[model samples]
Target: MATKRVAADVPVVRVDGRELRPGQSFQGIEYRGKDKDGNDVWRILVYAGDKWVETPDGKRKRVVKTDKHTFTGTFRDAKKFKAKLEAERQDGTYTPPSKETVAGYLREWLDTTARRALRPSTHAIYEVNVNKHIIPALGHIRLQKLDSNTIDRFYSSLEDKLSPATIMKIHTILLSALSKAKADGIIKQNPAKNATPPRVEDPEITVLTQEQLDRLLETAKGTRIYALLYTLAYTGLRLGEALQLRWSDVDLDRGVLYVLHKTKTKSSIRAVSLDDDVVAVLRQHKEEQDEIKEIEGERYQDMGLVFATERGTPPSPSNLRNRYLYPLCAKAGVPRINFHALRHTHASLLMAANVHPKIISERLGHASIETTADRYQHLFPTLQAEALEQYKEYRRKHGKGG
Candidate 1:
């Protein structure tokens, strides 16, 4: 009779002079020869205690489950790692490796951890990135098998299809997810820490000149979008932030508006002062809206939004951009610009008047003064030249310089 081959009965793999066998125990550490990269490889097998399993005859047998690691480093490093593993074993802190896939872990994480921690809008973005981009590429890889090189390759693959700034956003999401996995003891470390993402250059900011802005407002005057456009230009608020504004949040008497919802950060929730012209425009806008509400009666869907459609519902951002803003820019004979450029226009106007950067940072609701400074640093050279000219004029007047 021929004997059936068992897993342990198979041939042993010889690396250099060392013998490697399946399920074999090591004293502490063993040299496993060099890897493909010519780095010395070592193996460590630590006993992880045992459990009971049913035998063929309905009897019970003790099955010892060992935690093993193949280290790609020197034997000395392997010994140190072995010692660490032994220490963890002594304290019952070591986690056995898992065979879960990246997709499985990410799905679980998004449903439980990320959903609880992230805001609704932010969480929606994360979900789209994960389901649409990440899972399709890296989902098949085992969670334990994922490494920095794999992540780097994945990022490289996206270079042709996505912009550097967009790729950076994806990297941020992956890094956050992997960081949580490490904290939960699901992975030994975050692979994203070593992965290299594409570099994003600081883009040249676009802003409308004061004359161009005047023409734009003139073209948009008496139109429904005028108030929204004026608000964005003067307040420097993001399109989403302005759209989320409520009637209650605006105080026409106090000459200020509170940014309560759709704010990017805690710093973004601030009181933005309104100019007299802006206050007057808003008061007129309110009266017109009240008349429309009375005309619509109960048919209007009033959600207290300051900017809404004729039915009192929030207007679509795409419609505002394509249907209104672009056409208005053409009619006004001004260079076409996105709504965000209006915010830049406001900041540029303030900077031209020599407004303090600290006040600018506060008004823009930047997380730090450094952020504001870094963004507008391109405009500083002209300001510096002007300052030097002013100093020279002062010296000439006082007869201090020839």
Candidate 2:
């Protein structure tokens, strides 16, 4: 009887043909290898065209040269390769997230929430806070794993590294992000909800004394930055609001300046009475702008801004601060403070002058009367003194002596 053949019993290479030419082809079944146990591991027949071919034999395997220049070689056993390919297909190991970073999420949140619910300028501020501060610190951290302890550590680092107001802004950004995360189910709860932000001490405000104000005005005469300083001091308009102001908003005939729009706060949309000093400064400033327009002829772009660059674009906050406000303060020999501090100085001086808190709130366009009282309460006399004065006044006016 003929002996049966097993795959491992065969050698690695075999062939049926004896010799090969330059341009012919052949077919064969090739066995890749066998398991530990010797077995005839068979695969489907393979056709080779002009390639080196592995031919299987009962006792030996051999490489054969075909008629063509190269012959195709096929594996007779493919259990291992098949298993690996199926496993790789099942694993599915190559995909990326829809949103990748905190900065990215913040931008999406601003587009979706802040833009829809808040003012455009308010949304712009949130974008500034995210880009300038928050993204640099913790943007790489995954939103889902952001815990209260992580936020606490971030706030602690900011308190030591940055200004109090900057830290407060960072806290505000984190709170807003985490609140959105909770709403979207990215996190179970807001980590920043109960997180204690760093307590910010109010910085000292620089208010010009009457002597200092008079001296500064005298020094600012004949300069382009003069009326801007006067408007900041007298009307308490923020830098952007002042820059956005048009001649139409100013009713010189009615002696009232209408703050119909603002860039700082949403509440800053009301009218303010123009006192004599403010009116006089505006008149002079208008005359200067008109002269410039006459000199430039039609080349000048006229937006009618109360405060604008000579070329007619709006004045940038930093440009106004550095080039105008700072030099003016230095020249006038007054202590330098930020343009924002001008607003605070206006409020503080009003409180010192015993202006009613309600009126001060209205002038500053505060959302609530309590906001004004809370900010300026320290400058006022004690509550007891106020109560005693009220009682005395009431008695003097209404009490009848027997």
Candidate 3:
């Protein structure tokens, strides 16, 4: 009979290395060899203060933290490792990091601090990065054992498969989490502090020409999603902010909306003005929704979303584009772009019409006018052309040049 090959298991960080209780003093170092670096490496040791820690091979040993010549993070070959510890003891210069694993600390941080500090959507993203990416790769390494070189190598491996933006996000999670560990005295210093993360390019913008926008609206006018399409083009609400909306958020009489949620920063929350056209569409949509509610009666879920499935629940944002917007865009003789193109299109249209950037920022719920300007920087060349023409006209009128 042939034996089947089994995949090797990954190493796990051990939490019981230094079991010394406070007020109990530890003396002497045990010389253990380089760890087996294999399955039997999972030797969990527990000893009374005076007893010896035995290696799996029957010799006595204890894995201690070291700053140099490390075999497994801080763990080194026990003979030289013991000499270093003894010297540190004589000099009184040794400080030990906690025996916590990277995975363990990250779980705690997410459950306690990150869950409270970040928005739900943002927390979800962080959770995915930590649990899915960081944990699987570095979880076995002790938090104190984690070093810049290890982190850099991990990032280098991800570069081909993941975008620099994604790698940067992973770096941000590590830097922030490790900084917290340092603050709590879990580690002496964050190894990630000096690590280099990948550089990210500015987000690409996609805006439609006025002719395409007109054709799209003309085709969309009487469709079920027209109100949504029009709202996106006019108000620039992100797909999430738009989908998360309730009837209460819309003020038809005031021609405004209060955007309470979106991805990224908290600064994305702001009030947006509705054009008269958008207000009219919203009003009609509301009346129609109200009539549907009356008919559906007890069966209506009443989620209060402005855009919803026929059953009144918020549909997945991804599905909304493929099912409605993309097909409609194709039929309308316009090149298809992602749903966010409407936001870019809205901002571009405002800039082309020479509207103030502050108003554009407010309408788009951007954190600042600087953000608006940066996003629309591509449009500024046309602005310069228009300005040059105005300057020539002024010169002709004043007779300074002919």
Most lDDT-accurate candidate? 1
Query: Where does candidate 3 stray beyond 4 Å?
Result: 1-30, 33-96, 262-266, 399-402
lDDT of 1 by residue, 185-286 (tens): 888789999999999998879989899999999999999899999999999999999989999999999999999986899999999999999998889988
**Candidate 2 C-alpha lDDT tens digits along 334-397:** 8887777777778877766667888889888888899888876666675448667979999998
Clashing pairs in 3: none
Model 2: lowest-lDDT 10 consecutive positions: 67-76
- Provide the overall lDDT of each model, using Cα atoms, as 2-decimal numbers: 0.86, 0.68, 0.77
Please count the clashing residue pairs in each candidate, in the order shown: 0, 13, 0
Worst lDDT run of 10 residues, candidate 1, spans 1-10
Candidate 3 lDDT, 1-402, residue by residue in tens: 011223353222222354322122223322122255531111112221254588789999765534322223232333345565456556645444357899999999999988988878789999999988999999999888899999998899888988999999999999889999888767767889778888898887889988999899999987778888889988888888888899888889999898885545667777888879899999998988888889998888999999887779888877878888899889998989878999999989888888888999878867888988888899999987987898889889887566
Off by over 4 Å in 2: 1-103, 115-125, 263-266, 348-354, 382-402
> Model 3, residue 25: what's the lDDT?
21
Error of 3 at 95 (Å): 5.7
lDDT of 1 at 235: 91
Please report how far candidate 1 places residue 148 from its true position, in Å: 0.6
Task: Tell me which residue pairs clash in candidate 1.
Answer: none
lDDT of 3 at 395: 88
